[model samples]
Target chain A: MDNEMNYRKSLNKSTNKKVIRIGSQNYVVNAERFKEFKKNVIAITVSVALAIATFGYVKDNIKFHHEKVDISLEVYDQMVDKGYKPVPADGEWDYRYELLDGIDPFDLSIYMGSEDALSILQYRGYESWDDYAQQEGYKNQRDWYNAQKKKVINPETKSKGGK
Target chain B: MKPLAVGEMLTLGDEVEYVVMSRLNHNNKDYILFANIDNPEDIVVRIEKFENNELCLMGLENSDEFDSVLKLFGDQINNSL
Candidate 1:
């Protein structure tokens, strides 16, 4: 008890020294400044950690995006090769086949010299042979030409129109 | 064919005539889907084009190439239908 009293007395006498022994450092500490400094350090550490995590997440997402785009491009190219065309996003649309223009399918005169012209007429010539065939009542243009060989129905050609 | 725009008439060695339904180019090669102007079954032939405006149709001998082309054509055809 006497020793404890002596130590307490010494501590009281050393009040003017105004120094705290913290770990191995004998220094005066300002409680308010220490608290503020500790708060700033914690805040900085958390912000850096969050920043690193966010960067990693963003990088992963970008890689995934690139891979998705690459796959889509590959699929699109394959579709094009297979004759797939993209539909218009918005406009007048219909389910029926619309005739945009007429395709002059070989202009039958080109096949006049063909050996199989008679055979083709005997086979494929029909009401739906083409735009010209539908307009005219000619299933066999070759037969029509043969029938009108002497007569001139079309003044432009001085012969019957084959197509 | 009404739907296909290829209007050129192709005469074969057998003196049979055919019309093109569609054509595809892949890996520096051309493939044609044609049907006899008479008998209507579709036939596929590989083709080589020369500067002389001549197109030589070759029978597809490689089973793998033929199968690939057939599958690709079949997908598009089915989708269109």
Candidate 2:
């Protein structure tokens, strides 16, 4: 029993030493170096506090105004009801109709026929599809329309019909 | 008021878990409650809170109504905890 008690005491002492070592690593400071440590801590705390204050101020003020822009399902539906169309999922516009309009064909198709699309186009300063096409440097629509037709009609069918 | 560490601020895309704290009033009679989410720093969110000792938490992504967010958060927390 006495030997067992001694072993337990040694174990406790080792455990205590390990805890002390860990605690010292986290919180212990030398008395002689206290002034320098205190100054460093104060500087770090002040800088961190200032940064936080500035962040809070900016977030509460300027950022809130921009972040609060309302984008709701109702608003999206309303835009659609107003004759705007949604952009295609693949982000490409179908420009086949533009080729028939006698406008230049190389103009990237705008996702037209939706309020959202119109709003986006208008926001980008496009008044009409023609204006957008002209800006993109497409020549007149006849060549574009012919090319589109050829793409739509199979070449084999055309050859068979000709023969 | 030390600036929160980079890990403290909730970013646009982050998965977090939180605990409901208490309700607080913002402006006028409008009250908002907050929860301490599992962020590096305690994220005091306004969209969720506790009522009558019942926990409530909310989701910002799928919910537009504050109440819905609170309900969802509460339910999720309850189920998980």
Candidate 3:
């Protein structure tokens, strides 16, 4: 309390001027008017600080309310039955899948003939099938390719490879 | 056969093109979530199995299996947010 009083005293002493200068003209400063002005400024600052704190609290409360509602198994079944699919929030699609120990079973950079795919493989430092297969924990290129092939169902190439 | 990357669209036996939304590998089994191209809301979740190197989408016949997958997917989305 003593420290706060001293601080306020210092502030007042610094701001309270005896004379006001207006374009080379000196006028007597009104102490009452100066005090009122300072009071208003302080009030406005407090009000703004309070408003910001309240906003943050309300936003957190709303987020907590949303998290409280757990989707039960029955509710999930009903949603699927009604043809409503689970949709992730924007920019959060990457969280939908867990790439089993950093090994992506769906990564087709090895099989794609496109330059874009080749660039991706090169970017990953894989110069040959041997490098890719070894890095991917496969014994060889054929084994890795065979394992990955079993996960894909391409209708366009179905008749060609008995897929 | 080659690995079909996620987000790729392909026609099925019904001749309806569907978009592969995502894949979830849980409990030693792989599952795929897909949606009809025309109506994305019309979605389906199926067990992805390879028999004799042939990929097949099998319907979730067991209710418990379906429930667990649904819960796992729901929890993941919630936690991500």
Candidate 4:
């Protein structure tokens, strides 16, 4: 056919060039440049692809290097035997009557483990927060603080600060 | 140069085939989301342009542009979901 002959002629004319295919169309390009471009494209694409894939995999499976260990109950029991009490749950103390007695609420330092907090915990038949946290198997006071913050302190249905 | 449409496919020099999933314009530039035909989950975004009368798919020039394009695609995908 005349069309087949023309196609053959065109292909024979560009013997030094490479055909770059995009979808269904083809473009004749410099053979050496096309090879270099393909190499660069493959390298960059493989790297980016690996990065994107590893991101999803890492997001789901990889944990922070400094992971907090679960509290060891055995260590906790030993501390309890040494006369340390566990940190009290909400509503364990009644500060309402104390407030009425003219003791400053600020002096209680309720959440803060200040000297006032130490005194209050001691008065309530429990050891100081530092001792309790150590007894509770926390690595350090900071670890205890962070762990306690994440815990649901008080439910709204259960009133606190009252007898 | 022929602009690739969604659902169209192209084969690279390595013989790996990719299918265009979506196309959009952001910051006055055009981009297309394409994935390995064999592995649909393996997706990559490229800047769509024409050079010397040939369609070219190029990597984003900067991370800022990459992030913006990523956000645009993320928002669109999230909305669909």
lDDT of each: 0.39, 0.32, 0.43, 0.47
Model 3: per-residue Cα lDDT over B1-81, one tens digit each: 333445555554445555555578997777665545454433445666665565555666453454456446544433433
TM-score per candidate, chains pooled: 0.28, 0.24, 0.30, 0.37
Put down candidate 1 lDDT per residue, A60-91, tens digits, no spaces.
34444564465445544543454543232354
**Candidate 1's C-alpha lDDT?**
0.39
TM-score of chain A of each: 0.31, 0.28, 0.25, 0.25
Model 3 spans with C-alpha error above 4 angstroms: A1-163, B77-81
Alpha-carbon lDDT of model 3: 0.43
Off by over 4 Å in 4: A1-163, B62-64
Better of 1 and 4 by DockQ: 4
The order of the candidates by TM-score, greatest first, is 4, 3, 1, 2
lDDT of 4 by residue, A1-163 (tens): 3333432332232121333335443232346544544555544344334434443333222222112111234333433454544344473533322222322222233233355455655555457666655665666445555454333221223321122
Residue pairs that clash (backbone atoms under 3 angstroms), model 3: none
Which residue pairs in model 4 clash with each other? none
Candidate ordering by lDDT (highest first): 4, 3, 1, 2
Among all candidates shown, the one with the greatest TM-score: 4
Candidate 4, lDDT over the whole model: 0.47
TM-score of 3: 0.30
- Pitting candidate 2 against candidate 3, the one with the higher TM-score is 3
